[model samples]
Target: MLRRTGIPLLALAVFAGPALAGCGGGEPEESAADLLSRAKTTLDDASSAHFVLDSEGAPNSGTLLVGGEGDIARPASFEGTLNVRALGSTLDLEVVSVDGTVYAQLPFASGFSVVDPAQFGFGDPGALLDPDTGISQLLAEAENAELGEERRVDGDVVREVTAELPGDLVEQILASQDPSQAVQARFSIATETGELRRAELTGPFFTAEDDATYTVELSDFGADVEITAPPTG
Candidate 1:
């Protein structure tokens, strides 16, 4: 049993630093729409990036660490380690998407199995930002957005923005093949470069008594990386 109340993900921002004004800008800064729009443009322009995802609470009820470098464009692919929570161990997992097909490297009797994507908790990794219902589109759908304190992270000023998300937006970010919950996300962006540093998403995707939260950290934004298909056994 858990309390219905817990620290909202944004609460982490308070520890950033003394409250400070927005980042220095001569253009009076842009609206969330414009800023995110440009950031989306930047992300869309990128061919690949390295990413890590940490999530917990109701739905999973266990800690999960999944990360790897992959292409951001359609036919997305990623090679990384997925800690086998049940076994209390970690294993290498490779995910690939070419055209519209998505597949994963699963375990098969001391060997590896190239199976469908569903078993790995993903419906379509490549379409996560499909320009229609992707993260960029989710930000485009953001409402009640308010800027929060600006603080320095690794010497770069990061700005926080909170907003309520529509159901579809919430589901789209889910790591599972199934997602049917309304969501809200706290966004952290780089003030100087308009780069998205982190995103914390909260939603009621688990059950009535509990909620789900996903913390996604995106880094190495424009690294040149190629995630190709694994060898056939």
Candidate 2:
């Protein structure tokens, strides 16, 4: 999802982190198209699943409990709630897995603002993991792909694939660019099953001394889920 700062570098990293961290393939002379296509296939085969969204971004880091249900047959949603501490106090942000719909009720803000998860824009779990309208189009946006080393996830070794951003994605990210700076977005996927594990966001979002890396751990499933709109004025 979109990073706090308007910096494209930071935004691209955070948004593309999933593809960068988990999206990879088994050892082989594989093309970028083949790897991405396979990743999409794995996601297409998933009926239901869950993960924890742990983000190391501005403000603080915490686990975002998430779970999903239904596949291509029935439409369902993954829902989660998290207690986030920013400044000196704590606020709750409710993340909905229906498309990119995220409802955040902050103490300072008037109320929840239904945000388009796409604002994060690198095929967030809400969309990529959805049974409908998944990473097919999003994959087309990739310009390059490379298979990295095997890593341990969930105690199992898995291949990591890094997908470089195409010109369109770069343009989309650079739309808000500053002449003084520039950056690229990458998407990593799991080589074995294409499940998104972690996402990292880095770049000029913060000052030279500030930390720009962010990680979101995508858990907490099998319970009943509901996403009611935040109360309005």
Candidate 3:
């Protein structure tokens, strides 16, 4: 999944850093469940917001712009536009899907493609930005969440947290991380605002078919944004 759609899925694993960072840690803080509750409360108060995601790889980096509306899980929808420059080439993936059909647009492409709604699952940029799905849920569930330790991502500081993501939630988190049974990923929430700051899943690097690490950081909120999907695809 990660290899086939490297540009799109990259956001799933590495985009939560800013939100989690907003949930800075200091000392003993709230419980995991408490943190999730508080984070949801804060999210409920937001009608709309912006997010910026950066993914780091050897010798290069990628950026994504995500805009979300409505509440996590029940969000009317979301839009994500990703710009990536790596290996001496630039690629852009623009996705917006609300209702049923999904729209996908790419750089150097004449136009967008209308495809089956299923194609846009977590693998697509639309679901990647939706609160009910992908990293959005992880961030919204971050209230009262605990912390583990601090780590470095793209030269930035990040903290760890642990919690259970049941049912569909489990699928979303796992899809983003691309974890195997050998790898154990611990999900965590922020202590200050109960936001999901960091989730660490450790195993072997470059061993999975995905050819990427199973870790991710999500962050950067309230940025300039615009997202629109074709009515039908």
lDDT of 3: 0.45
Q: Which model, 1 or 2, shows the larger lDDT?
A: 1
Q: Which candidate is the best by lDDT?
A: 1
Question: What lDDT does candidate 1 reach at residue 178?
Answer: 32
The estimated TM-scores of all candidates read 0.71, 0.49, 0.48
Q: On TM-score, who's better, 2 or 3?
A: 2
**Stretch of 10 with least lDDT, candidate 3:** 64-73
Candidate lDDT scores, in order, read 0.60, 0.44, 0.45
Higher-scoring candidate on TM-score, 1 or 2:
1
Residue-level lDDT of model 1, residues 57-111, one tens digit each, is: 6333332333333455533545554432324444456666655565556656443
Ranking by TM-score: 1, 2, 3
**RMSD (CA, Å), each prediction:** 15.5, 19.7, 20.0
* lDDT tens digits, residue span 185-222, model 2: 33455655565444333433323334344334332222
Q: What lDDT does candidate 1 reach at residue 213?
A: 75
Cα error, residue 30 of model 1, in Å, equals: 3.1
